[model samples]
Target: MRALMMPHRIVMLAVAAGLVAWIVLTGNWSWLPKYAPMIGQGVWRTIWLLVLSVMIGFSLALPLGLAQASGPWYLARPARAFCTVIRGTPLLLQIWLLYYGLGSLFPGIPWIRESELWPILRQAWPYALLALSLSYAGYEGEVMRGAFASVPRGQIEAARAMGMPRRKIFARISLPLAFHSVLPTLGGETVLQLKATPLVATITVIEIYAVASRVRQDTLITYEPLFLVAAIYLMLAGLIVLGFRWLESRQPRRAA
Candidate 1:
């Protein structure tokens, strides 16, 4: 794979200059020092939440897409249904249901409350993470299904003709091709996933958006905090695009 893009030095420096100018010249800075630590924590939490959920969701998408694309009817039907339902529903509704409905249900269950995992089960972040991960999986599952289906049947037949076992054939051929097919799309999905991280703030996760909200509440300066939040997300999305473009550049070359 191509090295992950670090982005352009000149453009990045210019953007940095612009942001610094904005921070210094335009907005209220008095509150920043007091809340700097909280903002730092929020930024870290947002990035962590996005990265972990995407990794978990993409891992799930592989099997889910494969099941729908090529597995037996039983597996395909359920996988199809899952993708349909998740894609159909509003992500906000799913988060609320999981956090309010299932979270409340878990506490009422005596065994769950008594279990060793009760502490984790009581928190909002776990539910938020679950909702985000499943949302990513649901969307990416369809992308992967299409990618898997597009893999040339001739390639599979060639491998099979060479006496390659089914498992080996998939490892050597299908998965990689499908992943490469979807690599460009995966970056866009990741950017969407990053935007979705703000939704977790509604569940008391205290991500960067929530930090912005707090700044607005405490300082009553709306535009400055919002400007910063927008800038942060914009930078993140740019990074994701550049990173994926680099991956696309690294795709294996085929000889004519």
Candidate 2:
């Protein structure tokens, strides 16, 4: 992966420079102080969205992932299908479908039509979080399935030979080992989900990107707020990378 990406370094650098130049040309740097607070507010919203969505996705994905890996065909097949369908589509469309399409069709339902749930769903946060969680769950489920698959058949057989119950074998050996093997993959998914949070703006979640758009609209300035938002995103992404790297490093590595 590193080798394949090396050639893109210069291209990425050029793009960054061009973006900075555009910002400098179109947006006054001095006004950055004025809009900085609003941009920060947006960043907080972005962070909240990431945290909430990832928590929901991570919690759901574990069971879904395990079931997908080892459950009976009847159970596994539908979970696999659900993951495939969600992963196959763009998240933006998923948000639109949940918030507007199915939302319109189920208008008679209390949650869909006229209750407090309506207030939550009518805004962009719920739909955005739902879409992000579902999207990440699909990818995370694959990661977990692969991790579970990496467990040694011999180990399971030995546990069975020792007369350990299925639950004991899974709880004591399978889950832990699989998790160790898949830590890197899990970390990558988490990081990807973090970056993807900004897409919530498409549904009106008012994430960093949304705030930048608003600032641009209000001030007719092109890029200062955008630059600030990018900086904030970059910082958050860096933190995620570092945190996950630390997690991956701290976990015990499996033997080759």
Candidate with the greatest TM-score versus the true structure: 1
Taken over the whole model, the C-alpha lDDT of each candidate is 0.91, 0.80
Residues 94-162 of candidate 1 have per-residue lDDT tens digits of 999999999889988999999999999898999999999999999999999999999999999999999
Off-target runs (Cα >4 Å) in candidate 1 are 1-24
Candidate 2 segments exceeding 4 Å error: 1-27, 105-107, 110-118, 254-256
Best-matching candidate per lDDT: 1
Check candidate 1 and list the clashing pairs: none
TM-score of 2: 0.83
What lDDT does model 2 reach?
0.80
What lDDT does candidate 2 reach at residue 9?
88
Specify the poorest-scoring 10-residue window by lDDT in model 2.
103-112
Q: Flag clash pairs in model 2.
A: none
Candidate 2 clash figure, as a count: 0
Give the lDDT of residue 78 in candidate 2: 83
